[model samples]
Target: MFSRLWPVMRKEFIHIRRDPRTLVVMFIAPLMQLILLGYAATTDVRDVPLAVFDQDRTSASRDLVEAFVASGQFAVAHYTGSDRELAALIDGGRARAGLIIPPGYAADVQGRRGAQVVFVLDGSDPSIAGSSLSAARLIGQAKSVSIQTERRGATAPLLEVRTRVWYNPDMASAVFMIPGLIGLVLQLQATLLTSSAIVRERERGTIEQLIITPIRSFELILGKILPYALVALLITLEVLILGTFWFGVPIKGDVGLLLAISCLFLLSTLSIGLLISTVANTQQEAFLLTFLTLLPSVFLSGFIYPVAAMPAALQFISGIIPLTYYLIVVRGIVIKGVDASTLLPQIGALALFGAILIVAATARFRKRLD
Candidate 1:
């Protein structure tokens, strides 16, 4: 078994070495994507362009505008004289939020009456709109508290809320996303590389040679998977180093545990590729099928969106995707630094997925070879 497997593994390594493009896609592409997406995929909304229409022209209104700017969440990009101009700014996408201070704002504050200020938010992008709305509300609440305190001649407010964020104190999206990105990159490279493996052999008319040989189906399947599994592990290590050193995402858990779970993840992904190989007659079909699997995995696996937020049907579907379980494990170990006992459920799920996929892939590949 070892002798037969060694030849296939060595051949795969030779093929990878000769193919520069494969090497780039496996290594360089994921690194570039990690850097680009790390910055682009942030949820922290800062410096949101704000358009202000101050009808009061009073110190109170100016102070309100200054407060928004000082919070570092909003920047006054346009100071409009009329509502039309403010609306135009938001319509043109120059401002994500608009603040309109009514003429009686100062009088309302001085007389201890409720001041009504209209905050118009561009609702085109829900995420940005939601964040801007929250910031605006917090700023408004703080300003209201300041007014009440000044009127009471007090040094401190009556009520103060202190929030303590755990695990990710800074609330940096990269800290939350980098671990998931590592899983995504691993799945993509492993599946794509192995998905095309058997198809490539068939396309080149080399599969017939293997069919005529004495290599058993399970040995051939293991042979084809092992090399790419090693490659996937190397890719995992590369991205982990980049995610930690370059993105400053700390790994607080046991490194050995992370790698062990990663190998289990690779098993499922490689098996998925082998399964694709048996079904797809051409490399293009394999690529397409791989992408079809990857899209749902990325979107529904709690990578970018929460799986709990998905509808019950989609949520049930996500349960079957190996990436979903792997992500829970990866984020648990990498971000929360939880031990194996804490993540036993996810570990068991990954182990089950690997077992099922590998067995199914072996059966399919064997049937195809016969």
Candidate 2:
């Protein structure tokens, strides 16, 4: 068994070594994805366009305006004299938030009297605008507290923080997603598609011609995956560059470690694809099966939501999905800049997944041939 497997593995390696494009994909794909996703997909909300209507134009109103600017949450992009003007600014997409300081605003605040600041937010695209609202409200509440403390000499209202996000600071949703997409596109395209490559030849009566000669299944698998893998890798690079340059995402992590982990992830996904190919009767079947597996890897893998946020049962189920661990590894390396030593669990899980996939694929391939 060992002897037969070595020959096949060696042939596969040789075929892969000879393909330049596939080599590039195997090596360069992850980097590109990191760049694209990092920049395009962000959780941090900043520079929201704002319209202000200051009725009093007093020192307090001025101070409040300054606070909005300094908070880095809003840019005073427009100023309006009336409520209608504020509405117009928002309607024209010139502003996301509007502030209306009521009459006697400064006097009411200073006299330990409560004053109201009307804030109008564009509920359309609430994710971004909502974040701006939360930040602005926090700042306003802080100012109100200061005013009350100054007048009353000590009874300040309790502060309650309600945090909201725009893109993905904690979810790092882009970081988690892009890397997984790399695995998905490459593995399905390369593995399952290639799995049928040799079998299709057999179905077409050409495989026997090669089989009677010197060629092997391993060589065929290599030839099939190499070109597709390269394409996948190039896509990865495109994603990374776009994320970094176009979006201004910081690549403050270890590139080398990221690449290493990506390789493992690719290997596992590819193996599963290969395993599917062995069982599938046609390309359509293989495609369907790949999608069946892919859906679970995606929706169930905690790509869009937190595993911890999921029920305990679902979280446990997600533990077995290879992409789930890979998501953690890639996001951790890219966003948090975690090193290999610290990411041991994720790395270990990937390694184990790869081994299992490879073993299962090899077994299926042997049985299919038999």
Best by TM-score: 1
Model 2: residues with Cα > 4 Å off, grouped in runs: 1-154, 157-180, 214-227, 367-370
TM-score of each: 0.60, 0.53
Task: List all candidate RMSDs to the true structure.
Answer: 15.0, 17.4
Residue 250's lDDT in candidate 1? 89
| Deviation of model 1 at 307, angstroms | 1.7
Q: Which candidate achieves the best lDDT against the true structure?
A: 1
Q: Global lDDT of each model?
A: 0.77, 0.65
Q: Ten-residue segment with the worst summed lDDT in candidate 1?
A: 157-166
* lDDT per residue as tens, model 2, 1-370: 9998999999999977875544554454455445324433344567678889999899878888888899888889888899988866664446667888877887776665467777777643434554676787798788777766667674644222233332234434354456545555555565655666645665676655665656566665555556655665676677667777865555657877777777777668767777876766555556555655655555556565434334455657778988878766665555546577667778889999988987777666641243
Tell how far residue 315 is off in model 1, in angstroms: 1.6
Cα displacement (Å) at residue 55, model 2: 46
